[model samples]
Target: MRTDLCGRLGSGDAGRAVTVCGWVDRRREHSEHLAFIDLRDHSGVLQCVVDGARDLRSEYVVRIIGTVTLRPEGTANPALATGEIELQDCEVELLSRAEPPPFPLDERTDVDETLRLRHRYVDLRKSRMQRNLRARAALNRAIRRAMDAQGFVEVETPMLIASTPEGARDFVVPSRKEPGSFYALPQSPQIFKQLTMVGGVDRYYQIARCLRDEDLRADRQFEFSQLDVEASFATRDDVLGFVTRAVAEATVAVAGHDPGTFDRMTWHDAMERYGSDKPDTRFGMELAELTPVFADTEARVFQAPCVKGICLMGGAETLPRSRVDELVATCQRWGAKGLAWMRVVAAGTGGSALDAGVAKFLSAAEGAAVIDALDASPGDMVFLVADERPLVRHVLGLLRLELGRPPVNDGRFNYLWVVDFPLFEALNAEGEPIPSHHPFTMPHEDDLPVLMSGQPLDGEALLGLRSQAYDLVLNGWELGSGSVRIHRRDIQQRIFEVLGIAPDDAQERFGFLLDAFRYGAPPHAGFAVGLDRLGALLVGEENIREVIAFPKTQSGADPLTDAPSPIADTHLQELGLRVLPPA
Candidate 1:
């Protein structure tokens, strides 16, 4: 007899005969005469009752032929939909018995993550994992719906392609047919998606998988999926606006709340105000500049070039000297030389009271000016970094994020548009300028002459020459980034020159994209949203692995599958590879 899924049985089907099939979630002997089993499937859970003569165990594959009956008076469980009713079984068959599980399947059980990952299949049976997977499915569906509604045609890009080593390392696959040749998995479908725009697929979208060989973080994985999109005849504003709306809709649909509208900020403003492009706006405590106020001061720390400060709310008098020292140590870890701090206090009849660190260096007027500039209150403390602009910004930005309270369950989303990114970052170890985002990003039209003139451009000037690039940030986490691509061959060539990519190297590495651009390429731009990060955020988990069915550990090792293992010699021969002995 055919059976229905366990989660489908409910109070509406009471008094009707039904066949149910699922894994026994939990089994309990209600009394000597009766037994109740909680059965679960991918959809949800249901309760099943059988005579005590039959034996059932947890995780056993079971089939029951019974009538769905409403629970007796005072027995209905309001916590579950199927709780109001249960299946009264007359016949039961134990399809497969299960051994004792290594770990509990309930959400409340606190188990070691290493053990959980080792038995991911069993771990996925837990309620938390079930919820995460369901939320992931719903999020993907919402993304598809949103993209389709925006007139974007869904398309698939290639998986294997040439390696353009720029931002991150590539995972290479040896080619058996071509000896000594290798193919790298696409870091992103960046080139292919741009080519799709050139092919005149006015608008395109793909739930694409990307692989990158890089250091792992809570939000990063070896192979992750992204909601990739590209649009022809679109500007930076059009793409940013589309992503903002799509993110808001997706967040509301998946998390049951809207993220609301995003605030726009330039790279400079973000650095000066919050010290991070992805700033957490949920709380106060913005960074302020004190360079002008300390320009002529006798303070040795402020004697250097750029000086910026951030006032910790209600932190001046309360923050201890040891805590301030610890903050300084944290800055040093991020490559800052040292950290300088001053406590704001009330002015006395004799003179202005100040922290010992800067008391002798500052005159009364200068001290007051510093306090007024930062808008410091009596109880607030101010921390300053004095160094080059980039280091100062980096140090302060990191401190700002670190000092804020852990993210809370606030329903409102703080969205931001980080625009005006630099086209080229500083020179690499080889003294060649590197692409800030990527080589395909178009330089600002007005900056083309400056780029072609071959004049040496510093980081500040290059940053001011903004590209048509932008990143979508939600609550200080970068959701995605995109830029209007370089379509003109001459402009593309100029970018290559700026990045120190030789003519021969450019033709070899990016010939396919260049040739495609030559054939009627339109003005197009695209962005990629990290599906794993989005899923994790929607499920309210700290790490992306919580939502993934099978995720590798921080070391990029999969405990369940034991991947990255050495292959047999025969298999290696097929791939034209040989394992070298450890030197």
Candidate 2:
């Protein structure tokens, strides 16, 4: 409906007649006969010199036929894309007018999220939202282009399928024709894409929709999208290479640079060094093992299975005793027995002088060893956790991140591939060790005998068996995970048996998948990247909701339309369902 977008016009278009249509972003009046109106559209805003009226208000949708002219010497808006030019000789036609918005649209200011969400249409009119959504579109296009170049065949997967109660709760749909039967929305396209590999679709990809009935967080939504992928006759490295190329292309489309080859680490090393499988390697006060240093200590508290410490650089004199106590409380809340600490004061007789009240508990030898172990300097303090190895690492890991957050907007990316995850992990209240990633993940080649022929599949035995699964982590967030599939029938069944899934139950749950294996399922592997989460990071948004157009609130309600409202009784009856009374 217009010759050019509002912001797309510039000095190059000078002397050319153009018809621009957009909302009136801002209007300033010099007199009753002259005014300046910043007309805005998706492209951006163009300043229009209106000679007729001062009645034009913000958000008045208008069409203007005018000649582009350079702005006067001192009036050019250098801050804008169309800053150097202005529209003159304008004939304005108001197509629509709007009431004052509930909140400012042109300038970014804090607005209540609930109010903004309820009027998301108005909120999206802002420049920030427009940029976020546009970046997402670019990201998807880049991913598709890269994958297409790599010989992947895009395929759509089923949304309505039988419930496979493996991970998060599913959003189920009542099967009206079948009475009590229901079709659950896919938590992922995991099974369907794997089946595609078996069906002879050598390479598959989809920008797939997924639903999970789980608690919402800042980076999560009830409905999300994943770059679902699968491939036949592919090794773990083969899939990783393809995924890396696609992700680099997408990130480049958004950030204008490749992230280079990601650094790799084993799951064992990740936990020990950073205390997280998806460690944020951007900054380092890397975890230090003090267990060896305190082995022969006289202090009873330091006689635990593990002693891990992190040197809090420049935190010794900065954190007051009260704050230190609060940090100790925080550690206890995270399941630590108690947080032990030592302030690394001036260099002393052997290592470093201790200052904290509890430092008296340690002998001279023990204190010196602690300082040396952590490489403590004058401006450092050592915080230690002593307990079972797992809990100690867990506490120190949490504390490390709390203390040393990465610098904001450092223009650095830390992409890590964490491999060699245990095939099974012990559960505190479980009957048997469960699959660490998924039941179908192939056991590592070296651990195949431990899985297939171990006398007893005890917790210890299960822990020794590693999986061929790998996770892609970026800036401490687990972007996604992929694994080589167990295409062998015997191996798949053995894994099910080890997880305590009875033969009958296994058939009832994954019968189709196991049956597919019987029909020559080729070896396959794939990974899925969270589009919302990844896009948010790429665009420098902390909350994933910023990248989503119509996101639900944390409570999972659509304020705009008041979705998840009550359904009509007639419709429920037609579907043979009844709403139960609230507990």
Candidate 3:
């Protein structure tokens, strides 16, 4: 007999005979003549009543043939959508019996994360996991709709390609057919997507899977998908506008609320105000520079010209001395020399204008100016970090996030365009200057001459040299980044040269793409949004793993399949490989 989903049985079908199939969520014998069982499937749950039944167990795969009956008035469960009606079973058939599960599938079960991952198939049966997965699917659909509507053609790029020694370390695979050679999993479809524009696909997109062998973070995974998109003959504004609307709309459709409009900020402004590029603006305790204030003061605090301060509104008089000390210690741990605190006391009532290690060092006027600059009032506490400018800003920025006060503009989805990132970061331990974003990023036209002149752009000058690049920041997190690519072969080669990439090495590594650029490549720009990260954030989970079906653990091991395992020696031999002894 055909059966219906348990969640499909409802009060609307009262008195109709129905066959429901699902796992028995809970079975209780309410005396010999009455029993109530909660049946559940992916759709939802339903209550089933057995007028005469003796034995039942949790998680039993059962089929119930019954008539839908409304729950008696006042017996309705307000917690469930199907609470108003239940199925009265006249016949029951046990389809499959289940052994006791390692952990209950109930949402309330508090199981260890490691244990849950090991038994992920069972864990996914829980309602929370089900919801996360459903939300992720919806998000994917929304992305496709948005991109397709924008006239983007979905494209697929190769997974195994020549490895380029740039950015993150690659996960390489030995080529059995071509011994002594390897194929690297794509870190991103970066070069290929740009090449698509070269091939004259004006607008291209993909729900592309990317792999990165980098240190894992809450938002990062070894293998993840990104909504990669590129457009020929489009400017940064065009790219940014499309992504902003698409991402905001997708988020609202899946998350049930519009996060609101985005705000644009320069990279410098973000750093100075938030001390982080990806600032979490859910709360405010904005960083304030005290460099100038310190430069003029005789106070020991002034001895450090790079000192910065952040005032916790209304926390001055109430914060305990011990807690203040603890905060200072926290800054030190992050590489600050020390933390300075000033408690704002009433002007006349104050025996001391400022209270802390540096209190005595400040004159009355200098102390008053410091308090006024921060807009301090009685009972407001200000914490200061005295260190290098960047370190001071970094420490204070973290502390601001920790306090979680002053309330960020949570109601608004702040999308920002952080433009003008330095084209090149300093050399690494190997004395190789690394691309701040990547080597292919084109330098600003004006700065091209300066860069080629062999004079480095200082921090301030670097701010003026806008690349054909922009980042989409939503509510303080960088959702994605894209750039108007360097399509001109000469420009691409110049950038490589400035980056110290040898001509032979550049040709060897990216010869295909360079060759493609030679044949009338259109000016193109694109951006990639981390689909997993975006979905997790929309679902309000801390990690992207919540949205992924089969995610690896911190060490990049798949517990479900025990992947990255040892292959047999025979298989290695077939691959023309030999296992090396441990170093």
User: Highest TM-score among the candidates is held by which one?
Assistant: 2
C-alpha lDDT (0 to 100) for residue 177 of candidate 2: 97
RMSD per model, one decimal: 2.7, 1.6, 2.8
User: Which pairs clash inside model 1?
Assistant: 316-380, 316-381
* Candidate lDDT (C-alpha), each: 0.81, 0.89, 0.78
Rank list by TM-score: 2, 3, 1
What's model 1's overall lDDT? 0.81
TM-scores vs. true structure, each candidate: 0.92, 0.97, 0.93
Candidate 2 lDDT over residue span 210-329, tens digit each? 999999998899999999889899999999999999999998999887899989999999999988888989988888988998888888888999999898888887988899999999
Model 3 regions more than 4 Å off: 1-3, 51-54, 317-322, 349-353, 405-413, 427-433, 445-464
Off by over 4 Å in 2: 52-54, 349-351, 428-431
- Across 1-583, the per-residue lDDT of candidate 3 in tens digits comes to 5467777667888988988887888887888899888888888888888864547788888888888899999999989889999887657888988887789887776888778888998888888899999998898898888888999899999999889887788989999999889999999999999988988889999999999899887778899898899998998778877777678778887888776666677667778888877776665677877777777666665587587778787777567888878887887898888877777767676532666656677777777767866777777788877777778778888888766533332344455677766676555555545667876777766677876675655444544454766677655556787887887777777677656688899888889888888788888888999888778777777678888888888888888888889999999998899989989
Task: Give the residue spans of candidate 1 off by over 4 A.
Answer: 1-10, 316-323, 345-362, 429-431, 452-460
Which is superior by lDDT, 2 or 3?
A: 2
Worst 10 residues of 1 by lDDT: 350-359
